[model samples]
Target: MDDPVTFARKLRREQTLPERRFWGLVRPWREAGLHWRRQAPIGPYVVDFVCKARNLIVEIDGDTHYSEAGLAHDESRTAYLAERGHRVLRFTNSEVTQGGEGVYTVLMGVLGEPGAER
Candidate 1:
């Protein structure tokens, strides 16, 4: 009976290793003046990270996400967010763990310059 709010809180506390790793890199973006939220609830799902200002949601997927069910759910989630005018960025756990600079570059490209607010 864990509600979304409580579940999101638990997720924030128990973030996966990749989530933590990526957060370390992305969190510093705030210092550059870009806003992002971790373990944020959008509609029904609690996305791993989101920049509402940019209408972006970043999800770090673990092994479970490769399953058929997980893939279907993610597709639905992405479709829903897209319907709401939000863009979704999905990264596998290893991608964040290994592709540090690459991933950051991609994010920066999508996010634009730090202080360059839209």
Candidate 2:
């Protein structure tokens, strides 16, 4: 990808099955004012999802992401984003495809209603 914005757009267009599933679950919450952007760019990386208001970035890790090099890269990326005061959340592809219950639980735990059940 030439630029982060362009890359993000491409990611949005070419979403994986897990990505599509996760997005479908969250889109309605976004419409209700918990704003979110799919395939958003922050600095040099393109995150799977971002909530600017919350300074949160969410990434969906596929099998390749478990490789040594990928793990190192993800660590650096997380550190870089953290340096800029952003929180990163990661979910595995299977976790998403399997129903995204854990993903939702974490998200809500981080950004849910004040009195909502955990």
Candidate 3:
């Protein structure tokens, strides 16, 4: 398995729009109580973002994710994480970019509190 730091570096080199938005918000959230790992591998997949402190995974999907096949793939990924005792939260690219406050709210809810200590 790749180390989290190395994975994060790789992700930075290949940054995407959704990743930038998610990481923008994730930084503050990490300081509050959550620690997120980018491109963190789990089982046979590399999750978008993972907060092991909370056993949570956050996925940001792009337009291509609207396809039927993409949805099915996401469902399977979520199920895999669930089976591994992790909670998965998914958001679209637009949602994270245009709905920053809403995204933060949802993430806070999942993380338990705005100032939750893990």
Candidate 4:
């Protein structure tokens, strides 16, 4: 397994556009009550986004994720998180970046604040 520190450092240096956009848009909600950690280490897997408060992990998948191998890997990762009592929410990169408002709405729904606009 890779070192947690190293993994976090690498993630910090290589954040994708969707990751950055999501982070920026979610900052306010995080400040309000939801605490989130980017590239969080959970056992051997490093989640893209994790909200410890809600025990939820949000993953933004790029085009590569549509591949069979990527789907298998994601399934395994999701199972691990599920076993540990964490809910995983996946979003495509296009959905997050291109559909910013829609993405925020979905996230707000998941957060149990349906009417609250971010």
Candidate 5:
């Protein structure tokens, strides 16, 4: 496998459609002091999005994530992250593509910026 940093860089360039959309949606949050990173490396995993200041990691799940092996992997990953004091939020690709506003609303609450105008 490639180095985590190098793999993360590649992921940033080859973002899924949902990733691109979610990144765009959250990019403006930096003005609120909630900076975000896309395709960021955390230990051995490359998370879809993360806000280090908040210790939050957001994952966009695709079909592969619903598989048996995938579920196990995610469980371990989530546990590893939790042990390190990071909160993980997983959303399906369809959720982002179809219910982006709702997802944003939830994220604002998690980030303690509930009053942020969408």
Candidate 6:
């Protein structure tokens, strides 16, 4: 964790279940020219997924994110990203695991594709 490069590399190698699932869902989008990078380092943080072209960062929050300290940290991190003009989208682990279709639909909507009714 001392080195940001090393930390990002480790995160990519040890992706959580939700992270793995999310990546699987979006990997093919690269062919459509929606390039995304997993465990991308932006500033001092390593975002779960980032599409620089769209200025979008998607984060999959786990249990710890609900705690007071974690929430505070996330708030600041989000503010920092916003200051840099990046829009952040956060999804819980449960949301991705149990409602994957819904998550995919939301992402499609954010990506500006048609037919994302909800």
Which 10 residues in a row give candidate 1 its minimum summed lDDT? 109-118
Per-residue error at 15 for model 1, in Å?
1.2
Candidate 1: residue 5 Cα off by (Å):
0.9
Best by TM-score: 1
RMSD of each: 1.4, 2.5, 3.1, 2.8, 2.6, 3.0
Q: Candidate 2's error at 73, in angstroms?
A: 0.3
The true-versus-predicted C-alpha distance at residue 72 of model 3, in Å, is: 1.2
Model 5: lDDT equals 0.88
> What residue runs in model 1 are displaced by over 4 Å at the alpha carbon?
none
Better of 2 and 6 by lDDT: 6
TM-score of each: 0.92, 0.90, 0.83, 0.89, 0.91, 0.91
Model 3 misplaced stretches (Cα beyond 4 Å) = 1-10
By lDDT, the candidates rank as 5, 6, 1, 4, 2, 3
Give a tens-digit lDDT track for model 4, residues 1-118: 4598688779978999999999987887777776788998888888899988778899999988889999999999899999999999999998889958887888778785633544
lDDT of 6: 0.87
The C-alpha stretches of model 5 lying farther than 4 A from their native spots are 114-118
Tens-digit lDDT string for candidate 6 (70-109): 9999999999999999999999998888858888888887
lDDT of each: 0.87, 0.85, 0.81, 0.85, 0.88, 0.87
lDDT of 2 at 100: 86
Model 2: per-residue Cα lDDT over 1-118, one tens digit each? 5799888888888999998888876765676677788988888888898888789888999988999999999999999999999999999999999988888888778978533333
Clashes of each: 0, 0, 0, 0, 0, 0
> Residue 50 deviation, candidate 1, in Å?
0.6
lDDT of 4: 0.85
Off by over 4 Å in 4: 114-118
RMSD of 1: 1.4
lDDT score at residue 38, model 2, on the 0-100 scale: 90
